[model samples]
Target chain A: MNAFPPVPEMVAAVRSKRVAPDHFVTESLRRLEQHGGTLGAVLSLTKERAQADLAPLSARLAGGEDLPLAGVPIAIKDNICVRGTTTTCGSRILESYRPPYDATAVERLVRAGAVIVAKTNLDEFAMGSSTENSAFFPAKNPWDLARVPGGSSGGSASVVAAALVPAALGSETGGSVRQPAAFTGIAGLKPTYGRVSRYGLVAFGSSLDQIGTFARTAADAALIHAVIAGRDPRDATSSDHPVEPNQARSMDLKGLRVGIPKEGHDSAIDARIRARLSATQERLLAAGAVIRELSLPHAKYAIPTYYIVATAEASSNLARHDGMHCGVAAPPEKDLLHQYLRNRAQGFGAEVTRRILLGTFCLSSGYYDAYYERAMRVRSLLARDYRAAFEQVDVLLGPTTPTPAFKHGEKTSDPLQMYLADVLTAGANLAGVPALSIRAGHLTEGGSELPIGLQLTGPAWSENLLFRVGAAIESYWPEADRLPPFVRSQA
Target chain B: MIDENLVRSVAHLARIAIPEARVPGLAKELAHIVEYVDQLAALDVQGVAPLTHTNAGANVYREDEVAPSLPVEAVMALAPARSGNFYRVPKVIGDA
Candidate 1:
């Protein structure tokens, strides 16, 4: 267990009679039940359903079925619909929201034989960068209990990092996936815009929300992604692009070109992370990659543009949860307007409310041109910069986030400081490129170790290239296998 | 570029009653944010024709068809108070 077992290894073991899927899934349910309330990593557990699945699924495994993820226990982010489970999105309003259907990602994982063990926590409606904004229990980082797990997909990172499951699903709305991955020191990927279906993911910013995965290794991520990536008739925004398998096996970086943007070396990035990014590039160079320098002139505007556009979409998408519906209804409001207003104010947490307000203002009649339209224009220029650089290089390398996990409440009071957590990650979402966060190193401050991540990005649907470079880099740093003490103690 | 009056007005539209007490603090935070975003206007795109997306796809939306709505009883069951098939609510906007 000390070695980070790839999903394929676990599958092979289950298939070869080394371990039983029932035994593994049973223990996983027990461990999740024991750790759920304590770690706050899980919001709901599919106990009876999981138990019922084991017998038939175990029979399938024993019969030598070609399951994409045989006996691999995976968690779904609460925002991602898991048919019978509560997709809370970490808000009190949807405390009992049980969608009659599964999200496209869930269906893909299930059909591929991945068990939906539990649903992990998330920021309310995927609004904040830190998990603290969750109206339910906040997911504590496995690396440091007192510190926050970078969110809104923080719980997904924590579980995979904690080894509660071999893999999990996470969504990124402006680095929600990658930042938490960097903060928790796991490998997480945000597929290119529309690469995966958005059919049942509770919408945040439809343009930027991407359903991705968190796994211990890049190869495992590629395998899981292959299962989930395809056109969905349900999601109009989903790409019908032909599915391309990971070419990582064929990826020999002997002459592959790599680019490093000079803007990535800004003041906000931590020194340790910067050094790790440099070291990763050096390793790639040693592997025969021609590393070049690329500068994104408008990199600084990414945060503003992301916040403006994401929040604007969030405000509209969230309007459907009027209390009179299945969500928390206000106690007998006077009329329809009162019903919507009262329920919304009470249902949403402080952070969710703040974003809705900000988004509403940006999309308001008087300010749309100045804010929303302007942000869209800026988004184009950012995409152009990446395109111009991509013409010269195959992939880009950088730190996933400035610093690793910040302490809980470190930036809660200062809104802008909180926004800066995604400084290194926001640009990818704006550019609509695929990016991944892979655990690279560790930092020690006051004897409390924090995990660091190296971000590798590629042009649309170029995630295969990321797996190639990241798996190469993952070989150099073996700490990815080292379990957080909390996970071991709880086990 | 942002003002307190606009903040109140936006708050009104959003339906959240932000106290005047918090308006000053909220305005200050929003100002810093606006200054950061205002830089977008500085780009030298005299006629770059704002691009919608680097990759565009038309909506494959299916025709809206009538299907089984949530059982009216199950749906209204969630409402706080009700009279007949309609939901009952407080007296909103005078006698109307």
Candidate 2:
């Protein structure tokens, strides 16, 4: 029940039998009811409402409505709001909060006949690299239950990799989507900044956050991305550029130059992850992608710079959540001071509180220049390096993360270690490029199954090119549907 | 390195209360970040122009226009406390 049927297989199922949406939803619900809480991925399942919504779509399909996403069920991160459903951002403060309107991404899926199944958990406000910071529950890696699924999009990645959902929508403020995708062994793409509209997404580090998608394959990702991404008058940051067909890019990597950053190759990465990445390079070379070595001298500074800028922006965006006015309302005391203070003290979680403080410190008078300004300067150098690399090569290659997935709480004691874990993903965000993480290989024969991802970073709006190369690599070595033992046990 | 008091002060400014027990932990954690950032002082970036971290060459622009914002009432409605047209809140500054 948990094995991921390829996107074509699911579509064929819909087209061949005109699978009833109710029947499809019922089966998924049964799988979800038995398996969801254990994974800690699903926050709230819209069983009653989703079933009713699926009924009409089922009827339409039975009547021969050829909806592209007809009968397809998808999950969205809690940060991306779906109207009438709770969008908590995995914080206690937002637990009862519901968006008055749907996010552009949600609207796209709903309009395309996709069933809104559930809102998945995420790190509180997408601040942490791992989902352990979620106030509700930390999502466990589906592969090894003790391990993390990566984050702040951990729940989104876990559900897809575990085959609970075919695809999911996630957001990346640094490596939130890609890292989780890499850790959980799923296909994930972070579109160019402003390529996707920010309207209706709960804002956190607005300048850095881009809505990305996660799927079992690259083609499925492009299809979902094409549906949601485009210009919208609702969001000023949204580009007026016509939505280009990001799909249709085929397995053509011939004559493409893929750059391997000299610094990206670290001896510290797990040996198995390195083996998979090296093998992926061989496959790309076989397809005629010339691999070149380039140096980003300022790559070391990416982590600090990302945090400074991201957290500073996050501080400003989250300011509206003052308990006095927005989010969860506390008791009205006689004095405004007690009312606001008590509300805030009780509302925010430990992780959210810690970030707000760090962000506040960075943005405060007398220190902004030393921290925020300097960090901005550092970010520029990283971008400059990428620009130079792009002049010579079409894409850059590296391991998506230093390691695949770590046991939960291993890095919780030291936040710096956790921040450092994003070393590979942060540089791409700072460079403002379209980057993706795709599973390249597995380890340990039959008994022990470990997955590792190879990352590709391209110039802005070059996701189509990345897919071309991705499809080539995937073609050379067709990735089997690798599911965890837990799912198999259920079947 | 960041001291315990700085952590407490920052926490207060952010309106988040850290129990006394957690302050020591946060202070230790924050000190590592501050210590690592100090490495920048060793670099010789005297004359280099600050790079634009927003590396993408394309400036995704939309024609500027005035549009309807969230209805003032609806926005104010999200506020836990409101007074007339304004949101009610604790005085950020000292009371006169």
Candidate 3:
């Protein structure tokens, strides 16, 4: 029997007594164990905790309590804390650290009746664009095993693409969520900064990080987004603005003004992606939406600005893991300085160390004004560009990534090449806007088809509008039956 | 170019050790990244105020009333090494 069902179908089946919660949990675990080794998508499975958490839910369902996500098994990126479970963040530093409290997002999801099935892998500290940076193992794309599922949320994206679970939660600092979702041919949403509470989300870039959802469709993403996106007292930066939570509501695109940034069509974008983008625009135009060309003059600076700002924040944030408090500790030494150095050197992987050093260099006293301050100013300019574009158009459209997933070890040797993969997706994070990556179409490469994502970024707190546009696009180009051949054969 | 000496100094500042053998490779990579980021210098950001926070809210504070905190034992449980009610660490002050 097919164990993987989308969120809505799974919920309906369980609610109507067609399927039991225990059966869903068991089947999900079995499938995860069977396929997880090949994909390397899951870091640790919380089968015992999931079963324990589901027992009371079964009784509650029998009591006729209305639970929107009753019995739905969901995976979370390892970076997000889950109490009493190993939250590795795909780094050796945190190999044994089990958080004492659940992240606000995890707490809310559990309360909404979702079963936490497993913790997925990620780039160490959510720093890399590919899961190759994961301390343990890199997650491979389900469509083509040789290619990568994008990172730092590669594990979450891979599992969802393989239909291991209907949906998973991934965090985005830059393009960690959207890029992976695109590479894996799924839908992912990076909520506006501060839309989701950052409490207990091991910070990579404090200003840019936000928890996002990966699902098979836009509506499914919206369902999970509603449950997780909200303000919390624990997160001081979280927005206190009222949330409408109408993301799942579908709407027509009539009279909508969609802005196409001229910079989005630059030479770096793949021909297939450009063609798919054109097809999407044609579809939008047919749906009674007006497409207009706009400009973001400072767009080229996004990658550089992101690296500086993100790494600088990362350097400061990662300083807490000095072995005395939490995480892996090195053998004791007589001197305190040696202890810190030894523990950190032994704990962090190469990519993480590189970022920490880069960040430290940027924030150092002499270089602060030149690197950190300049990047921040450029970031402001990028935000200004977005605000200006929004005045003319209701939403901005672009490619999620310049190209599709590359082969393993393709860009690992060159750090800048890997960083370029996130170029198109970073602007949304820098602008603090809500962005969604929908599988617009597919591209054939090396005798296999890879997915292409079209990104839609809206003004702050405009997830509802983005989701509507996404749902409409999904309808025009339905991907409901486009499961990878591997998954299809299994079914 | 960022030399090996600069890379070592930065790693020291970050409290991450760079073994002597890897210093040259690390410096080369750091130099490449720094060069890539240096493109920002071409932008005209004169008089543009830096955006430190995405949201407008600042100085968010709750009332000074006491609130329940995580139990000391629970907090200490995650610590790598701890004595009763205290986290144990390497000695900082050395004998003269």
Candidate 4:
């Protein structure tokens, strides 16, 4: 059975006192205990912490205080700090480090009466496309235990898909949230850059990173988005642009101008997935939405540009984990420099080390102009592409990933093959646009049916419009209500 | 091509000690990624501006007021090694 009802239903029930807040927490904890280990979705459950805070929250709710996310049980990707909780970014280095403060989003979630029950896993420092790069363990897809739940937000995506949690917070540097959500057949939203605050979110590609939401449906994703997104003085990059709750009032697709980016439909995409995307477009057309073939000519460069810029920032941002102040340290050595090196070397996993090296090389003095600066110039061009395309249509549509989730160890050995997983989704991060990924279709591969997602990206801060379009697609998509095999077998 | 030596040097610069055996493999992987990213060189970026950040906001400043930070003990408690009120590190300017 699902642990809880949808966000709005649960919130209304809890707020109206018909359902006790503690009841959902109990169910969520039970589900986490049941499925978390099997799916490798949970790193640590904050059972004791969550229970201790519930009585007071229960009091607040009983007192008739209005909380938008009242009584909701949510999971946070381990990278985002929850005060006094272990904020491991899926690396052994800071495996046991507890943060002293809550991330701005976490602060908002708690203030709105949401209980953070667990910390989900991710690729180390959100570097790799697959959670297989997690220093501890890879999160498996609920659809097929043999396949990876697309990552670096794999853990968050997995738990939501398996009904371990109603909603989860995942950070996306490049396709982390959307890709994982796509692979897991859930709704994921990467809010426009600056639409959400990054304060206390462990920095990885500071310019590209945004705290995104994952849920079973786009409307639930929007509920979490509304609660968490807004300008935070702590995050200077956060915009003061007005943010209003974007809950879908109607699944109205009338006259919605959706642009089909020609680049997004490249031959590189899996033909099966493309067929699903076309079917979704047909659904939109049937609903009176206008569709146009548009061009984001520079879309192809998004992956390479995102890699350079993201890694460059990661290299600089990760410099703090020298083991001098916190995290795992090397054995005492006479040379401080060597000790620092050894501490980091031992703490970070292979993928983290690779990204750090790549980033360092990109930002190195001689190569800066050729690699990093040039990538930045190309990034500007990519952003311009979105700007121009948005002028032509309200949103750009495409397959979220080239294909469905793959078996573990399939792309692990080949780094390039793994990076390609984000090719279709990373453009939004590069352009700082908001993108929503919702399950549009499913394909039977290797005897198991895996979900495929369609991504709808809009111009910056246009999350409300994206949610509307996503809801329309979700309504038409037959597979949205289907349970993953893992959940089905258990039932 | 990224050579093993370059990989080692880059690791050192990044303050990570990579094993000598892993250097060759890392070098190969970095070379592959670098080569893939080299596609940017073909783009005509002559007139384009570098966008380091998407936020168009200028420097945001606040009043210089004393604010409470995490307690010193709380901050110190997180350190891997600490002596008194300072983080403890290996000898920097002393003989081994």
Candidate 5:
């Protein structure tokens, strides 16, 4: 069965009046209502808000305003603030909290004529590798219902892969977008750290957080990226660099140096996934790109270093939800200090609590130099490795994850095992570079065929280069165009 | 290894209330993570400057001119407990 039409084609159809904007909105809401519950993908449906915004959108289109995404329906992860709508961040702490302003990325999408149809579910405060850490419910994989859709962006990935909306927005501190995108066959792009503004994305790891896009094709991902990227004065870290137009129809790879990092192909990668990576490399070679082998010695240390740095930042960022400032408070105590302690204990979930405790321990007086400071020093080493590699090659290629999607409860029981999920993807975040995960091929496990993703990394502010190469991979290795069983059954 | 007593003190420092029953389990979990991350100790990180921000962008300056800000009512709308223009928290001082 054919999947949803590419975002560009959908926009063309809408502009020509072949399909009305309301038609897209109505259809998306219908599918979301039908499948969202069973798949555990949606946190809240913004049907009322979406309908309220339709009139002004129609007026703009009639006024000949150039809206590139005119009438397209889209989903925002729950952690992103949407004005007058509940932005839970998949935690009970802020279950009723509503931001008075829109996130910078969400604001841009609305200005471009995209309708916000729903707030998708997520791991609480965007911390886990699986949606099981979600305070509400675990989002399931569309390919095999019993398995997990890799997360903290699992719901966003599931909806896009199931062709519910065409595309959605997800955030990545460490592999949240790419891992889920790999699990559910699609394209996930984590732009260079400051490439997209983080003005309104709920902070997880302040220094590492980035908002990314999810779509069935790399070209469509580029369309969304162009709208949301670039500087916003509110976000100090957002780059002032001009947004380069990266929607090339085809790219020439002759003499383009692609590096295959020896560290990325170690025994830690599943044998089948390693085979898929090798095949992806052959295609690049056939296209005239010279493949070079290299080393990143510090790559093995990324996971531990990321956990320390990320948890430390998270501990500091989450301190504001003290119940007195905002979010739900625990039952009143005799004194303010007890109230503060009770509020946090009752509000945050297990993983969140564990992280906060770990973060506090790392930054505490006695252990500061041993844990937090040392991690930062190692973080510098990771960044140095990326700098050295970029000097030799234009792009680096590797597996997006060690293996395909595992069973939901498989890794949840072991926190260390869960942390290992981001082993291959965290180095990019630590070094602050752009990485794109695209469907390379599929591997069969049991009676089901699971998708494998090939990742491409480049130096900071190289989004255009990354997207151009990503589009090339999707052209020849076109597994992204196929629909998952859930969508096929509906047909 | 992180002992249960250390876990309790850390939780206290972090301002999180932990039930006596949950402390042992939490202690074990924290210990595993701490030990796993201890692998960094083996590397000689002497004299290497800690990298805080990945992108080396420095202080961002803007105009000092005042601009429109969110209304007080809008900002206080999400507060769990609020008095007239103030967040109402539990009493801070104890009666003699």
Candidate 6:
């Protein structure tokens, strides 16, 4: 039995009556149970809920209806609300909270005939680079059990990498989705901001947050992206642009202009990872694509600008989480103010508290002009840089993360170091353009091989182009379909 | 540099309590992060307008029609303290 069939294959199998939807879901649940413990990829499994949810899809199939994603089991990141299921942002504040309504993306997935089998783990409130900030246990990378799965979408990426699920939904604020995907050697896409509705997604940064997908293949990611990309009235920030469905076109790299930004090749990047990126460029050139060196002069300001803008928005968004309205509440205190303070302090993890404080400081009265406003101005400069670069080239390519996945506690002690993990990927988010991370090659270190990702970023509303380029690049990797060692052993 | 007092003030503004002992360490970390982000000061953003949202659409208004809202009971159920369809909170005004 194939453990990780791409989305189209699963659809074709279901259509041909080769596999029953019920049976497929059961097998997926069994595998999730088998591997979830070691990987810590799943926080909660909704076996009964998934069976109930699949009844209608099974009936539709029996009734001769062709569903785009018939019987495909997908996992949801804990931050995205799944109605009637626990939506804990990997934080204790909302430990027992159940959202009353499904996020638009989740609702659309259900309509597309996808069954959500599990709610995966993540960093506390999706705040950290490594999943270590999870109030629960950190998710371990499938490639190396001792190392972390890059986060805050760590569990979403880990499950897909481990073949526990064919695809999963994760929300990206900065590099939450792509970084983890790079670490796990999966395809993850952060669609252009406003491409996907954010109505039910727990907000990290209102302007920067976007719902994304994770899958083994770029084609599968594109399929999922198409289902959830349309505008929704419920989200005022959602664009009214029409969704462009992924046309399963052949991989044609001819005539595509690829740009390599000098700023992307930072000194901090691992030498081996840099070499892998160079090799990818060579492959693209050989495929008849034009490669040129480009410069994003203001790209260096991405990290600082992203942190300031994201945190400022976060402070405002998170202000609603006081214990009075919902979530975990502290026992009644002497007054409302004390109650809020105690409840928040006890409920939020250390990293979450730190971010809240930082955000508060940035938006403080005296510091607002010097910090928040200045960061916004610099953010404009960074976006302008991308706009200018895109005019000269179709897309920009670079290593997804500065280095491969690191050990669990390697950078947790230093918060700034942790922030730098998103340095390479944050530019795409800051520019509000679509970007994808595809497995490029592997780095061998100390007898173990770790996967690396090549990120392709394009202009706004250019998801289709990004996917086309990603699919072309994905075809060149000979061992692209090989499962992680742990997954191979289990299979 | 961010000091313990600044950290305390920020935490107070955010309405999250920080332990007195943890303030020193939190202050140190916050200072480090601030120092790193301070690099933005070197950039020349003289006349650039802040880009708050990526798109140019503003005032995305919809018809003022009544729509189905979450039932009061459901909304009340999520609250920590509620009394007969109203969320109950501690009194803000004290007796004069």
Is candidate 3 or 6 superior in DockQ?
A: 3
Steric collisions counted per model: 3, 3, 0, 0, 0, 0
Candidate 3 clashes: the total is 0
For model 1, residues A125-242, the per-residue Cα lDDT tens digits are 9877888888988888988888888988988888788777878899988999999988888889999998999888999988888999899888889899999998987777788888
Tens-place lDDT per residue, model 5, A1-491, is 24668888888888888898777888888899999988899999989778877768768888899889888888999999888889999998888888988999999998999889999999999989888899999999998988888999999999998888888999999999999999998999999988899988999998999999998888889899999999999899998888987574458988989999997688989899898888878998999999999999999999999999999999999998787767764578999999989888888999999999999999999999999999999999989999999999999999999989999899988899999999999999999999999887688898887888889999988877888888888777666567777888884
Per residue, candidate 4 scores C-alpha lDDT tens digits across A1-491 of 74358888888888888988777888898889988999988999998768866878878976777788888899999999988889899998889889988899999999888999999999999888779998889999999999999999999999999988999999998999999999989999999999999998999999999999999888889888998999998999999889985665446778889999987678988899898888888988999999999998998898999889989999999998877778654579877888888888888888888899999999998899999999999999999999999898999899999989999999999888999899988889988899999988688998988998999999888898888788878888766778887887774
Off by over 4 Å in 6: A63-66
lDDT of each: 0.81, 0.78, 0.89, 0.89, 0.89, 0.88
List TM-scores for all candidates, in order: 0.93, 0.91, 0.98, 0.98, 0.98, 0.98
DockQ, each predicted model: 0.41, 0.41, 0.83, 0.83, 0.83, 0.78
Please report how far candidate 4 places residue A482 from its true position, in Å: 1.0
Q: How high is the TM-score of chain B in model 6?
A: 0.92
Q: Which residue pairs clash in candidate 2?
A: A325-B79, A325-B80, A380-B51
After superposition, the stretches of candidate 4 with alpha carbons farther than 4 Å from their true spots are: none
In model 1, what are the clashing residue pairs, if there are any? A323-A329, A333-B90, A334-B90
* Per-residue lDDT of candidate 6, residues A1-491 (tens digit): 25567789888887777888766677789889989889998999978669778878767887887578888899999999988888889988888788888999999988888898999999998998889999989999999998888999999999999999999999899999999999989999999999999989999999999999999988899999998898899999899887776764446788889999986676778988888788888999998999989999888788888888888898888888876777744567777788888888888999888888988999999999889999989888889999999999999999899989999899988988899899988888888999999988577776767888989999989989888889888887867667888988875
Error of 1 at A170 (Å): 0.8
- Candidate 6's error at A433, in angstroms? 0.4
Q: Judged by DockQ cut-offs, is candidate 4 incorrect, acceptable, medium or high? A: high
Off by over 4 Å in 3: A1-3
Task: Give a tens-digit lDDT track for model 2, residues A237-347.
Answer: 666556777663466677889998876677877777777777777877887779888888888888888777887888789877766555655666666555545666677
TM accuracy, model 4: 0.98
lDDT per residue as tens, model 3, A1-491: 24277687788888888988766777778888888888989999998889778989878888888788888889999999998899988988899888888999999888878899989989899988889999999989998999999998999999998888889999999999999999988999999999999998999999999999999888889888988888899999998778885558567888999999987788879988998888889988998999999998888889999999999999999998887887644678889999989999988999999999999999998999999999999999999999999999999998999989999999999999999999988999998999999887688999878998889999999998888889888776665348887787773
Clashes in model 5: which pairs?
A: none
TM-score of chain B of 5: 0.91
Worst 10 residues of 5 chain A by lDDT: A474-483
For model 2, give the TM-score of chain B.
0.65
